[model samples]
Target: MYLQTTIIAIIMVATFALASWKLKSPEISMVITAIVGALVGGFGFPSRLLVEGMFTYFDVGMIFLTASIFINIYSETGAMNALVRWIVKQFYDRKWLMLVLLGILMIIPGALTGAGSVSIFVVGGLVASVMSYMGFSKRRVAAFIYLFAMLAAVSPPINLWAMLMAAQANMPYVGFNVVLLVPIVIIALFTIVYTGTSKTPERKSKEHILSELPLPPEGMNWFKIITPFAVLLVLILLSKFAAFSIPVLGLPLTFVICAFASAMMDRKRWDVRKWFDVMVKTMDQVFPLLATVISVGALVNIMTATGVRGLLAITFITLPMVFIYITALLFAPFAQGALSYGSAIILGTPIIFLFNSVGLNVTVTAAALSLLFPLGDCLPPSRIVGRLTVETVGYEGSYMSFLKAIAIPWLFMGAIGLLMLIFPNQLDFLVVY
Candidate 1:
C-alpha cells in the first residue's frame, strides 16, 4: 500500500515534468496524474476534499481570468494605437546618453496589458520590428520587453500572482501590497546597469538614428490613445484597494468599466455584438489555464487526504535542519514556477505553504524565490537574464545565445534575491504567513 502511494505521488510529479518538457497542456496532464494518484491511493482518499479544493482554486482562477480578459479587450482596440505610436516616436527621438533607458522602456507594453499569447502577439511584434530597425539586437530587445511584461503579469491590481501568493500563505490582499515590488524594482535596475556597461557604445548618430525612427502621430492626441488603458487600470486599482468604495456594483464593476472603455475604443464603436465576441475570444484563451488549476487542486487534495503529502512534508523536514529547510525552500519554487506564468502562479501556492510551515517568514521566503526563479512563461532557460542581450547590430541565434542576452537581468534579479534573504528590513513590510 505504501509503495502504491509512493508511485502515485511519483506519477503526479512526473506529469508536470513531462508535460512541460513535451510542451503539452499542463492542466490536462495534471488531471490525468490526479486520477492515477487517486486509483493508487485507494478508495479511502476523500472525494469531498478533492471537490472542495478544486472549486476553491478554480473559482480563484476564474476571477483573475475574468478581470484580465476584460482589461485585454479594452487595450487591444486600435484606438490605443495613437498613444503607443506616439510613445514610440518620442522614445526613439529622445536624446539618450545610456542604453539602459531603452531597455527599461521596452517592457512597458507587456507590463500594461498582461503577457498572454494574444497580447504578446500584438506587443512583442511591434517591439521586435522597431528594435530590428533601430540596430538593437532582437535578443537584446526580447530581454527588455519580457522583463517588464512578466513583471506586469505578476504585479498587483491585476496580479493573478498575488492571488496565488495570498492563497498559498493563507493571508489577505493587504499582506502583499507594494512591498514585494521593491525587490523586483531593485533587481531590474541592477540588471540594466550591469548589461549596459559591457556592451560596446551605442552611437548611431542623430542623423542616422532619427531618419530610421518613425514620426509621432501628426494630429492625434496622446491621451486619446492611452486614456482608455490608463483609466481602466486606475479604475481597477481604485476598486481593488482604495478606501472609497462604490456602493452600487462593487468590485466586479471594475471589469465592467474597463470593458466599457475598451468597447468605446472602436472608432465606429460597434454594437454589443462585437463586445460579446471579444468576451468569447477571451474565454477561449483562458480555458486551458482554468483546467490546469483545477487539476492541481485535485492532485493536492488526493495527496493530502491520503496522508502522503504530510508524510513527504515530514520526511523533508527531517534532514539536517538548515540544509533541509533551505533546500526545501529553494526547490519548491522551481517545481511550482516552471516556465508557464499561469501555471507558476497556480502551483506556487503549495510551495508557499511548505515554506511557512518551516518558520521562515513567508514574505522573505517568497520574495527570495520570486527573485531567484523568474522567466515564468516567456523568459530564458537558465533563468539568467544576461544571456538574452546582444552586442552585435543584427544577430539572433540558438537557445544558447538567447540565454546570454537575458543574462544580466538574471544576475540583477538574483542580487535582489540575496538582499531578500539577508536584509533585516525584510521583516518590516513582509506579509506574515
Candidate 2:
C-alpha cells in the first residue's frame, strides 16, 4: 500500500513540476494528471471522479466568477483610479507616505477578490508604472507590487486558502482570521519598510507624477468613488457580525450586488449587453482558475479513494512533530505552482490532518501552512506572480531580477512561519474560541 501510494504521489508531483517548469497550463496539467492517477490506481471510471472533483468546488467557482465581474466593473467605474489619485495627492512630496499608500492600494483589490493576479493586473500594474515614473527601479517596483498583492491574497475577508485550510480542519472561517492578523501585520510592516526605503534612481521631473495620474471621468462625483467598496465591506461585516442570512446565496450575492452597484455608479451607461460583455470577459479571465480548482477536486477525490491520502497521513504520523512542521514549511511552497488553493487542497490537507494527529495546535498549524503557501506564488520555475510582476513593471523577461527583488520578503515570511512553528503559544492570545 505504501509503495503504491508513494508511486501515485511521485506521479502527481512530477505532473505539477512539469507543468510549472514548462509553463503548461496548470488546469490542463491537473486534469490530465487526474486521469493518469485514476488509471494507475485502477480507480474504475475516471469520469466519475472528475465530475465529483469539479462539483466539490462549484460554489468557490461562483465566488471567483462574481468577484471577477465585481472587480472588472469596479475598475471600469474609475473608482480605483480616483482613489489612487487622491492618495498620491495627499502624500505628494512625501516619498515614504506615497510608497506606503501605494502598498495599501495594491492590497485592496486582492483583499476583496482573494486573487493575487486580480490585484496585480488591476492596480499593481498601474502602481508599478507610477512608481517607475517616480524613479524606482523596475526590480524594486516589481518586488513592492508582488509583496503587497501576495499579502492581500493571503489576508482578511476573502482569503481562499485560509478558508480552505480552515474548512479542512473543521474550524470556522471567521475563527481563522484572527490568528492570521499578527502575521499579516508583521509582513505588511516589513514590506513597507523594506521597499519604501530602498534607494532608486531619482526622477528628472516631479511634476510628471501628477501628469501621469489617471484622471477620473468628467463630472465624476468623488464621493461616489467609495460606494462599491463600502457596500462590499458593509455586506461582509453584516454577514459575519449580524447573522444576516440571505437564503440560498451568501457572499457571492454580495459580489453580484456590488458589481451592479459599481456599474450603476459609472459615468458611462452600461446596458444589459454591456454587462453581459463584461461578464464574458471576466469569465475568460476566471475560467483557467476555475478549471484548476475543479481539477484539484478531482485529484483529491482520487487520492482519498485510492487510500493514498490516508497512507500519506499515516506516514507523516511516524515523523517527529518538529520535523513534520519544518518539512511542511519548507516543502509546501515548492508544492504550490500556479494553484495555491489547489496545492493547499492536496499537500496542505493531509499534512494538516497529520499535525492534528500529533497534538500540534491545528489552528496555528493551519495558519502557518497558509503563510508558507504564498511563497510558492513567486518561487522560481513556476513564478506566476513574479512573471506577472515583471510584465506589469515592463521588466520584460527579467524574471531573475524579479525573483531577486522578492527574495527578502519571501525569506522574512518564511522566518515568520518558522517562528509560528517554534512558538505557537505566542499567538494563543489571538486564537478564536
Cα-based RMSD of the predictions, in order? 5.2, 2.3
User: After superposition, which runs of candidate 2 have C-alpha atoms over 4 Å from their true positions?
Assistant: 11-23, 204-206, 244-249
Per-candidate clashes come to: 21, 0
Q: Per-prediction TM-score, please? A: 0.75, 0.92
* Residues forming the 10-long window of minimal summed lDDT in candidate 1: 380-389
- Give one digit per residue, the lDDT tens place, for model 1 in 1-433: 6676677667766765676557555555555555656666674455676687688576556554656565556554654344445445556554232333443434443333333333343344444455555555556666655555455454444444555556655676554446566665665666555444444345355455445544433444555566665876676566556746654444355556666666565646556787677777767756655665676677666667665676565554454545533553345335434533333343445555655665656665555555444443424222322222222223357656665666567455555555565442445555532
* Residue range 17-128, candidate 2, lDDT tens digits: 6765576577676677777777778875688778887788788788877888899888877778888877766775787888878877887777777788888878876798
